[model samples]
Target: MSKATKTIHAAMAAHVSSALDALQAAGTLPEGIERGNVTVEPTRDPAHGDLATNAAMVLAKPAKTNPRALAESLAEELRKVDAIDSVEIAGPGFINLRLSDNAWRDELRAIAALGETYGRSTVGEGTRVNVEYVSANPTGPMHMGHCRGAVVGDALAGLLEFAGHDVTREYYVNDAGSQVDTLARSAHLRYREAHGQDIGDIPEGYYPGEYLKPVGEAARERFGDTYLEATESEWLPVFRGFAVERMIELIKADLALLGIEHDLFASEAELQAAGKPEAAEAWLREHDLVYDGELEAPKGKTLDDWEPVELPLFRATRFGDDQDRPIRKSDGSWTYFGADLAYHFQKAENADALIDIWGADHSGTVKRIKAAVAALTEGSGRNVPFDVKLVQMVQLLRDGEPVKMSKRSGQFVTLADVVREVGKDVVRFTMLTRKPDAQMEFDFAKVVEASKDNPVFYVQYAHARIASTLRKATAAGVAPSADGLDRLGEEELALVKVAAQFPRIVESAAAAREPHRIAFYLQDLAAAFHAFWNLGNDRPEMRILVEDDAEITSARLFLAERIGQVVRNGLAILGVEAVDEL
Candidate 1:
């Protein structure tokens, strides 16, 4: 196979698989043995070997032999391959293989050959995946509360695409909720104020953001006092639609500052208007998945104050949820879960998989929604995949002090404000430093600090240093060349090995739906390159661009160029720019 077609780990896995096939053909092992459980990956400790495999352990039982006996046979077949420098059978049955120097050198050439397209994989096999995120209620502008989810979802989509999945970036617009009603009422106050009427301070239960002033002004400009004195029923629907439209526009603009654009914007109001929820309800009822049932009262409410009510309930508990969930209120209105269930069912119709990025506060609703999707899809015998990833809130701070909310947004710090203060790359890279579900603190002072403690700066500086070295080398007429790659030493080869892990990282991160793994891997790769650079401080011979010899300089420059390429690729997955200079 061509170098561009497979990852280093994948190549090693194929070698093991070939050895197993040879064993079966020789009658040393049973035919048709399941190889799905076999795995070949980098060893946890580099001292063990370049790669380790569980092939022997996985096949020993089927072969009716001891693990050590099977490993001995496997090692014999593996030794026939030219690339295997040594194959060691560790405890029980683990087979560890160390490759020749030519293997690592060839990988460096592959890296330089692939360039920006490196680290991409076809592991997803073109499965259509729907990623819905940042479905914040369209009641206000984008705030810090919604920032993390937006970044995570966008990065995950990028990662999936890199892994060769047909991904759809979607945003579920929550325009049918009661919050829009509050938004319309708030817009009316601002509208009345725009008409020279003294609307008093924002009343309770109304949005108080000064950001809504533009919406009010737009409403005045369009309506021109046509509904100034109309009844609430006459103007409520008009303002609701108008406010939702304006807020969605504001949200898209705010998201643009962070380079996030969704491919589709699904509307809750439209779904209800098209009777999707009713359709889902009818399907559930026909399949005995839902029925008229009464639910227990509030967990902490007194029994005397609790009123028993009968409502249509879904069998969420049967699918691992805590309790049966109500799909509609007793008054015959669809509940939030009802609308959300129908929305996910609609999403599943066009995609093979679904992923939702929700805030940590929505953790309680996760099980119910997962159950709904399971029932909806499994009942139809489709078995579509679904995942709900919860992202925790970010605590904004400056110089170790908790930052105050933005007066413009009224309730929280706006995402645009933070992006403007530090930059889109800093916000994005910092949000990915820690896992999404873990608590994160975005310190205005710390993220921009030019030190090793700051991962964003450290990783970017590594790429910048490599870029600077390449530029200076070219200035002296030492262009990177693959001809001198054979002259490189173990340290240079070690850097290539680290960079070669990018493909595996991308595939694993996409499979796990955790894009932060790419962030973590970049930091490690950056550290390795930085350590190699520091080697030159005491040993002049270890420097990349040596004055006496052009051959070694070309070899090291080639290594540095590829290292920079890997850094840029990893940063690209996180939607961060790889700066050429600090």
Candidate 2:
């Protein structure tokens, strides 16, 4: 295999697979055992080896043989590979493989050659994936809750693209629901307020956010009270459209502050107006997936009327949900879920797989939407995967105190506020420092800290240090070259091994839909570089700018440059800028 084709890990996996084939051909192993399930990944404790494989443990049962016996055979065969320094069969049936120090040195050269595209892979094979995220309602500006999903979705899209997937970053604009209607009413009040009516106390059920005050001002400026005197019916439609359009702008601007932009804005109102909801209803009714039924009063919630009514319902229970979900209310207006089902059905027509990054508050609805997709695909005899990633909330803090926010009272901190406080790079990187499903606290004081505890600062500082070293080296009449790179010491080689995990890290994180892995991986890489840099504190011979031996200095400089390149590439996936200077 060539370096241009795949990473070192892929090459190793292929070689081991071929060894298995050779064993089967020589009648030492079974001829037809599944090999795709074989996993060759890094070990947590580096003391074991650089990489470990469960080939024997996985294949033993299928091949009907003793695992240890097969491991001994596999270990014998793997030793013949060129990159393998030694192979040790560890506890149970895991085979640990250590690569030569020269292999680590060569990976540094590969990083230098590949630059920004170092860890990119063809694993996705051009599968068209739609990643819908930050689908905050188009009623007001994005608040603290929207920040995590925004960064996670954007980073996941970039990660998938790096893995060679055709990804579409999308946002589902909920402009058709009752919320938008309420938004229109709120804007009408704002319009009145803009006209000097002194609209006091903003009625009880309407939005009270000051962000809508601008929409009112814009409407007053544009329409000039043309429909202010008109009846509610005449002005409702006009104001609804105007408010949604303005709210879209507000949402987009908030997203732009965090360096996020969507490839498509899917509108629920458009889907309904285009008769898609009706079409979906007709299709479900034809397949008996929908029916007119009276539902039991919903459990775990208190209702005033508590009366059963006949409604059009989707057969959610048939697809493993607890109960059938209603598509339309008794009054014949479409429910929110009805419009959403139609929207998803429309999205499925364009992509092979679909992903939605939603807040954890919507956790209960995940199963129903999944069942809906399953029924839709099964009914149509087409397999399209739909996955929902529930992002837990982030607790905003200041000086170790919780930043309490409420959308109703408009006391919440906006995304723009946080970004303005500590730059877009800090906001994006800090939001992605944890998994999407895990709740994390974002302390304003901690993120901007210059210490190693702040991951963004630490990684950026490492890159800056490397850049400063290289610039000073260049100024002193020394340049980097491939010559004498293998003469590096143990500390340099250890950093090389840690940096080489970038390729595998990208592939794994992309597959798992987790971008936090990149942030953590960069932290580890930065830690390794910092540790290696500290090696020069007491030992002057290990420093990068040695005056007597130019060859050794050039080799060390070349390695440092590639380390910076890896950090830059990793930061790119997270949508964070890699600063050349702290």
Candidate lDDT scores, in order, read 0.92, 0.89
lDDT of 2 by residue, 1-582 (tens): 265435668777887898788879877788878887898888878899989999999999988888898899889999998889999999888999999887777787788777888988888999999999999988888888899999999999988999899999999988877888899999999999999997879788899988888888999999998977888899999999999999888889999998898999988888889999999999999999999998888676456758778999999999899999999978898987888888888888889999999999999999999988887876888788989999999998998999887756867899889999999999999888888899899999999999998988999999999999999988999998779897797888888888888888998988888888999999999999998888888988888888898999999999999999889999998899989888
In terms of lDDT, which candidate is strongest? 1
In candidate 1, what residue range of length 10 has the lowest lDDT sum?
1-10
TM-scores of all candidate predictions against the true structure: 0.98, 0.96
Query: Candidate 2: misplaced stretches above 4 Å?
Result: 1-6, 300-305
* Candidate 1 wrong stretches, greater than 4 Å: 1-5, 300-303, 406-411
Residue 535, model 2, lDDT: 80
> Given candidate 2, what's the lDDT at residue 280?
90
Backbone clash pairs in model 2 (N, Cα, C under 3 Å; residues 3+ apart or in different chains), count: 0
